[model samples]
Target: MLQLEGLTRRFGANTAVDGVSLSVPAGQMVGVIGRSGAGKSTLLRMVNRLTEPSSGRVIHDGTEVTALRGQELRDWRTDCAMIFQQFNLVQRLDVLTNVLVGRLNHRRGFGATLGTLFKRFSAAERAMALSALARFDLAEQALQRADTLSGGQQQRVAIARALMQQPKLILADEPIASLDPRNAQVVMEALRDVNRRDGITVLCNLHHLETARHYCDRIVAMQKGRVMFDGTPAALTAARIRDIYGVSEDEFDTAPEMTAPALTPAREAALPA
Candidate 1:
């Protein structure tokens, strides 16, 4: 279980994330959806210690996350994996080797050095890498350098790398923002598959309303450093959206075209299954 109690973060006098408290049960898939500067990213980063909170505690499996440091901190980080809108992989490294970097925490310095982010892997590790890649249909590109793959392919490779870590919790910040509609579904399907089949907890940041409504078990909407709404997709109505994003239905309808369709479960499964 992941729990946050009175979580708050501030920069100077402005609190980017206010007194937020929520608990995500194991295996739950939660979506953080809000407009720019709504503090969604700040809240998500607090989970994996990427952004230290100014106050409050984050508890994961009974351990206080922020209190960990040194080797203990290193160990805690291994339990969670983070994905980003920009695929943060070593550009010169081959896809397979890049995935193996996820195992760095498990291996000691020298043993971990055996396979740098660009080198080949051991027979056993190679098989493990292949399995992760196969799930995202990037096994054929295992030997290809990260820079050579398409944007969608790179994102899959990033997901494969995260899978290789065998994380208990996956935190993604605007993961699909950089993808096309088709590729976005592909990546989202892979995430939903792991969340459903393996029961790994998933927490993602989404800009599109339909995307959050379709894939998330719950949606958290924030505005001006506060959680404005927390409920099912059905509850994120026009009024709630306006409260958080300051955009009413009239404003949305009158503005330039910005309609995006919900990604159905069938479409999520339309990936390389």
Candidate 2:
């Protein structure tokens, strides 16, 4: 659903993403893993047009998403929602309303009016919003203010908001960085469920390797603003990772793979199921 060709981004003399090209198909989840300043985040940001590319094109569906601005850019971003490391929700707003903000671009006139203020949502929209919260088992807390919810719950709410958009692609940048192991698992599992059932394309940038290995259909490794490796989890051996990170085995304790979004599904022939 998304394609990046020869994508490059530079800040002064330092290139953050260097000529990286990759494809994320519809319903696929791909993980981006790299060390600090390795350009993983830069690559993801460029895909959504949040960071303008110095060169190259980001193609979504068929349109060239790069170099688009104003209404064109806004419309492109609407179809491809971005979830961040920070929840970025309005702390004082109710969880339900926070998610309703996803519809801001699509909703019009009267229906938009009902949600902009303290106005109550319609039966259908409310149900859909509540269903999103329940996907992360936070429906009970929908009426509660966002500040009262835990960090994990808040991130889940953010994901629900993205889901409410019915986006074609989801970009998550270190989404689990702020959570504990248990909570991180919760959020990641929620993402997996969304990708599986809804067929939404996902590209997540993560620091951990083991985590990516487990969750991603394909792993794209970056180093010094360029793609160093792109392959299956099995192909990313210890030696390969060392080459990408330039770190020795003794540099860290745990060797957890940064399993993020989609693990590739095995191809099946279209015969009889």
Candidate 3:
């Protein structure tokens, strides 16, 4: 289990994530939804320690996450893989080599690390990377430069890299914000596949309510850095959504609807079990 006790972060006088606390169990797919500047990204960053918390504690499976340092912190980050809005891949590198980079933390001593830097990995590791790529239907593109693939393809490559870490949890911050509707559906399905098949817990920050409703097991809504609602997708009523977005009921009714396409059998089969 992952527990956040009064987690807070402040910059100058403005608090980004305010005294928020939550307990997430393993194998749950959670969607964190909120408007822009609602502190959703900051909350995930604090959990990953990419951004330090000003106060409170982050405990994961009995380990004090907020107090870890050096290798311990690095290991924590490895176990909790982060997928960003920008994909964060080495554009110049081949997809396979970029995926192999996830093993950098597992590389022990100077020689191993140096070998990884030069793109030298064990045969078993190479096979593992290939398997991850195949999981996302990117194995054939493994030798292509990352920049050459489409946005959705690059994001899948990023997911493949995360899988190479064998992460227990995934923190996805606006992962599909930049993709088109079709690609967004594909990416979200990939995330759901990992959560279901591999039993990896997912905490994804989503902008679209319908997408979250369709994909997540539970929904946590934030407003101005505070969690305003926490419940199953069906329990997130229209009134609650309006309240979280601070919009009038009429405005909410007229808002453009964004929904992911239904997954077909062929596409579902394409994603590895």
Candidate maximizing lDDT? 3
Candidate 2 deviant stretches above 4 angstroms: 109-115, 118-120, 248-273
Highest TM-score model number? 3
Candidate 2 vs. true structure, TM-score = 0.88
Superposition error at 221 for model 3 (Å) = 0.2
* Candidate 1 Cα lDDT to native: 0.81
| lDDT tens digits by residue: candidate 1, 1-273 | 999988887765567789888899999898887666678877888888877788999999899997998888777777888898898999987888889888778776775666554354568777998999998898899889999998889888888888778889999898898898999988888888889988999999987878888898998877667887899999989887776566874553334332223234364234221
All candidates' lDDT scores? 0.81, 0.81, 0.88
Q: Which of 1 and 3 is the better model by TM-score?
A: 3
Model 3 lDDT per residue over 55-95, tens place:
98999999999999999999999999999999999999999
Per-prediction tally of clashes: 0, 18, 0
Count residue pairs with overlapping backbones in model 1: 0
Q: Candidate 2, residues 1-273: lDDT per residue as tens digits?
A: 788999987665567678888887799888888766677777888888767788899998889998678877877788899999989999998999999888776766665766667646667778899999987899899999999998999999999999888799999998998899889889888998989989899998887777888888888887777888899988988887777666753342244433233212131111111
> Candidate 3: which pairs clash?
none
